[model samples]
Target: MITEPLEGFLPLFRSWFDTAAMAEKVGVSGSPENLLVELDLGPMVEAELRLLNHTPANAAEAACMLEVVRQNMGDAGRSDGLDLRAVAAVQRWLADQSTNEAEGQPVERLLRRARV
Candidate 1:
């Protein structure tokens, strides 16, 4: 039955479904949640980096790539796909950058390094 597969997976899917429904109900234009679904996760990672002001040259490149991905997604009329690895990598890099900044290292100097 159609319910068979859902019966097993409903618990896992329920939260996600509820979130989507709530987002729709809120219906705020240009909300981050809406933009998030429209944005490639890779570029979203870069955007997060920008927010943290930890944009290395490589991170800038990644951001540009993500922009292209966003454009392509727009053209294709599809939501941007999420890449968990890219998000994690960017988050880790941001954390490292924050640590370096706290240690009194200039962000510009750290950006030029092989490591964050």
Candidate 2:
């Protein structure tokens, strides 16, 4: 189950999924080549769509959506396929949602590893 804060963050995160000019607002500059954009996002598109449509039935379901977004975004960042700023934003949000120390550790570890 997610807390109020986590629940509230869903809309904000969903707004950042735009692939057009909005990408610039999210700190990703330069337009992607039309033909390559789909391939660039790869698996992230489906997860992003789920959030965009608010399809998650509950907090746990929403968290799963975030996990999918996080993993795919991180993978995209590796080859400059996606923007790190967006990935960092997602990581920070995920880390901030942890209700306790134990719950936060894995997220913190991922954040640390990604930064390295």
Q: Tell me, what's the RMSD of every candidate?
A: 15.8, 11.5
lDDT score of residue 58 within candidate 1? 47
Q: Which stretches of candidate 2 lie over 4 Å from their true place?
A: 1-7, 19-116
Tens digit of lDDT per residue, candidate 1, span 22-112?
A: 5456653675756445633454334333322222224553353344344334457224333333343344445455554433334444554
Model 2 TM: 0.24
Clashing pairs in 1: none
Which candidate's lDDT is highest? 2
Q: List model 2 lDDT by residue over 4-70, tens digit each.
A: 3335445545443444324434544345654433436543454354343343445554564555456
TM-scores of the models, in the order given? 0.24, 0.24
Which lDDT values do the candidates have, in the order given?
0.39, 0.46
